[model samples]
Structures are given as C-alpha cells and as structure tokens.
Target: MSETYYLHLNVSRFELSLNGSLGQSVNITNGSDPNAANIYPDISYSLLTVLLLIMIATVAGNGIVLIAFCASRRLKTPFNYYICNLALADFLVGIIAMPGFIVYNLFNEVWPAGTALCTIWMYFDWHMTFESAINLAAVSLDRYWSVRWPVSYKRHTSVKRTILILLATWLYMHIAFFPGYLYDRIVNVYGEHDCFWDLVMNRRFCTAVAVLGYYIPLSVMVFCNWSIGSMVVKRTNATAQDPDVAKKYAEGETRLTLAKDKARRQRQPLITLAMITVCAVICWAPWVIYFTIAPHYPTALPDILITVGYWMCYLNSTINPYLYIATSDDFRGAIRDLFCRRSGQTLSGAFSMIISAAPKRTSLETSVRRAS
Candidate 1:
C-alpha cells in the first residue's frame, strides 16, 4: 500500500512527507495546505511549542522520579516498586520516541534515518505502550488484593512479586512487537518509500492486531479499574463503621486524607493505586480511540485527530512525575532535598545551568542507548 503522510516537527514546524509503503522519505515541506481538502497544519506554532514543553517535562520529570526512587532507601515499597517500573517505561519511551518524532515532524515526515530507525521508532512506541498497559493492570490487581484481601495482600505482596511482575511486563511487550516486525515490511508508494505494518492491504491482519494489541488490553484495563474502584468505595463505606477510623470520618474528615497524612509521616508511599489507574485512562483514552477508529476512516480530520491522540499518550509520562510529587509527601521531600541545598535556585534554570556547568557525559557513560 502506497500512501503519503506528514510529520510536523514541533521546534521548527517543518513538515516532512513519507511514503507510507516503504517507510522511507521523499521530500520535506514547510507546511501542508489547510483548505485543500486534506490534512492541514492549521494548528499554530504556539500549540506545537506547548507540546514540546510537555515532552520536555515528561522526560525531566520522569528522570527525576527515577533518580529519587533509586536514590532514597526509604522510598522502596511494593507499590513504589511498581511505580519505579512505570517511571522507567515512561522515561524510556519519552527519550527514545519523542526525539525521533521531533526529527520526523521537523523534517516534514521524511524519515531520513532509514528503515532501521523506523523499526526502532515503531518498536519503542508499541513496546512502551504494552508495558504501560500491563503495568496498569498489575497495579489494579495490586489494589484489589490490598482492599479486598488486606491480610493476604500484606502477606503476599512483596518485592519479589513486584520484580516478577516488572520482568513479565518487559518480556510480554517485547515479544508482542516481534510479530509486527516480522510480518510487516516497508514498501515504496507514490514515488516515496515509508514504513508501517502494511495494514493498508491486509485489513484482516491489521484488524487482528488492533483487537489483540489495543481493544483487548483496553477492555482489561477498564475492567480492572471498575473492579478496583467499586471495591475501594465499598471498602471505604464499610470501614467507616470502625471505632477509631470511623470516628475520624464522622467528624467531617476524609479518612483517605488522614490516612495519607499519617502514611507520609512514616515515609510510606502515598499514591493510591486508584489514582494511577485514573491517570492511565485520561492519558490513553484519546490515543486508543484514534488507533481503533483511524483505520476505519482515513479522512483528514481523523489523521489530524490521531496525531493529537498520539501526543496525549505522551502526556502521561510528562505528568506522572508531578503526580507522584503532589500525592506522595516522601517524594516531595526527596525532591526538596535534591535541590534545596543550592541556595537561590530557580526551577526553570536548574536543568539548563546544570547542563552548562557540568562536563557532558559521553555516550559511554550511559549503557542504555536507543537506535535512533
């Protein structure tokens, strides 16, 4: 299937054209015509700028979260263990996928890095998505066990189990991408080559993947969220009858709030598993809709809407670190300790000044390297 697609680089607002069949590039352009009955670059540079900001925040925020979780001895718990995995997944995707996307968009959809890089982009995009989905499911189950079987949950939920789940998430996501890579080949179309899963002609196979990769996982996530949420509400209502905890609730106070404050005093993790699930839904709902619906309607509006949907998924990684900081008192204090020692510090200038002040770390220093 030969088709043309455009990628808009946020920094410079350059548009690149791609041959959807070969996953290669033909030429780049400044912008697409908005009113020519096709996809439009009607969105302003300011909006793109905001996206770039969001991307940067996601990378930096997740980076800090990873560092804090790794550095602090007190922050390690069963829930935090899963959160660390989530942060790692988000950080990897942000670093690998976002820059490549910026390059594609800035150059106007032309994938100058060749087919191999295209594979990498596709892999990172799908792999991280799978890991995130599984992580959400795992977190939901974790919460379910915690609330419904509190005693058993305390006995069974351990660092070892968390490790097993994290490993399983990685293994599952990598294996899932293998089939897409094996069967899907890049082809040249309309005088240019592009990379995709070759779903244009093989609608059956594409539909299967959509069902397996997206719809099924979405359904699972929805079920887990609903089950866990219902249990939490019921558990809270039941627990309200207790003497100590109930007395607090009867005094026009939220038990969850007091419980969190008490948990903070002990440096326990504060983010409820329910909150994490909600964030996942908010960040992924748009992209999932776009993915499922785009194949059916290949109109300009769908294309543009799907592009927006892709960015919305990225927003999850960007805002998750902040969520941890806001919800978890321990994380907030760790961050404060990380930078507060430096007097007259400004949040905006901290990263920039650090880069400028310190000697740059070579690629050798970082073991994790992305192909693109």
Candidate 2:
C-alpha cells in the first residue's frame, strides 16, 4: 500500500505534484514532512487506468493525423500545414509529456524521474500545450483574411509562406516563453521529489507569457470566427435574394454552378475552424479559469481542479486532430487510404513503404478547403 500523506495535489502549467496540505507549506528540502500523519485515503492509483487510457487515445489519434499528413497529398493545403504543426505539438505532449506525468501521479505525486527529466517535462508540458492554442489561433486569423479578401489571397497564399508563418510562431513562442522558464529552472534548485515551479514567486512574468501564449490567441480565435461568420451570413443573404444568381443556378449555367461550388468550398474550412474554436473554449476554459484563480486561493481550491480540470486541457490536445480531420473530406480520405495501405496487419516493410511512398506536392497550396 502507498503512504497516505494527506497532501492536496497542485497541478498547474508548471507545477504538477502534491504540495503541502492546504494552508500548510510543504518543505521542499531533503527532510521528510514533519506532519505526514493525515490519512486521506482518496489518493490512489485508481486514476492510473483512466489517465493511461486517455494517454493512449491521445497518442493514437495524433499519430494517425501525422501519418495521414505525410502520406496523403490531399492534406497539403496551406492552413492545414498549421494543423499539422498543431498535431506535432499535441503528439509530443501525448508521447513525451503524458507518460511521465502519469508516473508522477501514480507514485503519489512524487516524481519518479530525475530532477533533470522533471524540469524538462515541466517545460515541455506548458510550451507544447501553449503552442497548440496559438497555432489554432494563427490558422483562424489566416483563414479569416483569406475569406475576407479572396482576390488578393490567391496571389499571396503558398506552402512556403505557410511554412514561414509556422516558423515565426515557433520562434515567437520560444522567445516569449523559454528565457524566463530557463532562468527559473536554473536558479531555483530543489530536491529529488521537488519539481520547482515558482509560479507564485514569478506571477507577473508567468501570467504575461500565459497571456501571450494562450489568452490573446483565444481572443483572436473568437474575433476571427465572428468576422468569418458575419461575412458568410451577408453573402448568403445577398445570394438568396438575388434573382439573377438563382435563375442562373436553375438554368444549368456551368460557370454559375462552378462559382457556387467554389463559394460552398470557402465556407467549409471556416466551419471546421469554428468547430475547433468551440472545442478549445470548452476544454481549455476550465483549466484557464482554474489556473488564473487558483494561485490566489491555493489553500481553498478543491483537489479536483488539478485532476479533472487539467485533464480537460489535455483532452483539448486529444480532440484537436479528430475534430479537424473528421470535418475535412481530404483528411478523411487520407486517413482512410493510410489504414487501407496498412490493412495487411504487418509492421514488416511499413516504414519503408511510408518513407518511399511519400509524394511531394508541386502545386501552389491555397488557403483552407473553401478558400480557393
């Protein structure tokens, strides 16, 4: 049986372990706690099963998205590159971050890994998670502009520009986040069990990075979606009342039908982006609210915030690939083709086939599905 130390677990962006009992400061030094006598029995390995299942699902879903992106030329759209990057971030979280985190919680929140690994996980967890949110925001903004200005978008949109934008996001996020994080991890030395997260000490700096990484991006997603939504509504109203457009469609005008089809295509990507925004808001809002409010009432908040709320954020990562891919026929077809190729049920020669079979896209990548 594991030792019951009656400590409330505090899982945040940086910190992911049990601290002292509420209102009681747990000593982080070499010595054991003076008051380890409370017998709270709820801290158990019961969560391991749930957590592990989620971790597996998270990995498998994102893995398929990555594999599909690589294998299918259909998914080579411009903004979809951003989706690919988001999948990479989420995949890292599922593969690299979640396993160690599960081990941390499994062993009563005392980290099972070395201090070095713990510090790395601490950074990877926040950075990748934040990176995903920002990527979605960037895609939403890009899609909005493309929808708003279809004529100019054709001239400007390209795979190279998409790659450049993704690079810029990675650079900007690292610059905004890593320097301060590196400073804290280097300066504040702690014990084997202690993964030092000086969020309380570095509140302003942490909160600013959080804003830059998450909250601002969140606002941008909302604004972009709203703008796109309003434009689509106006266009729909204008088209519905126009007798000329209706008559052309009725009279089998090939050009008019093609134009209408193109317009329908433009609206589809926004729908996908909007769906992602809804999922992000639902999954992230709890963790975001909890983290912002928890520091103030560290002693008073419920234990479930760390367990349930944090998992909700991770759920955001798990849900992203499926949500985005499921909506797009290209992604769906790509994923279907991928599984069919692997339908032989053999790992033998699979890697070679994947490597050798990957095709390069030579055409200019347009804006999202409906953008062209």
How would you encode candidate 1's per-residue C-alpha lDDT over 102-139 as one tens digit per residue?
Answer: 66665455555667778788778767867877776766
Quality of model 1 by C-alpha lDDT: 0.67
* Residue 123 error, candidate 1, Å: 1.6
Q: Write the per-residue lDDT of candidate 2 for residues 239-315, one digit (tens) a residue.
A: 78998876677766787778878876766788789998999889988777766766566656676777676678788
**Segments in model 1 whose C-alpha atoms lie over 4 Å from true places:** 1-48, 186-193, 242-271, 296-301, 341-372
Instruction: Name the 10 consecutive residues with the lowest summed lDDT in model 1.
Output: 33-42
Best of the candidates, TM-score? 2
Superposed model 2: Cα runs more than 4 Å off:
1-46, 253-261, 344-372
Per-model lDDT = 0.67, 0.78
For each candidate, what TM-score against the reference?
0.69, 0.78
Give me the displacement of residue 26 in model 2, in angstroms: 25
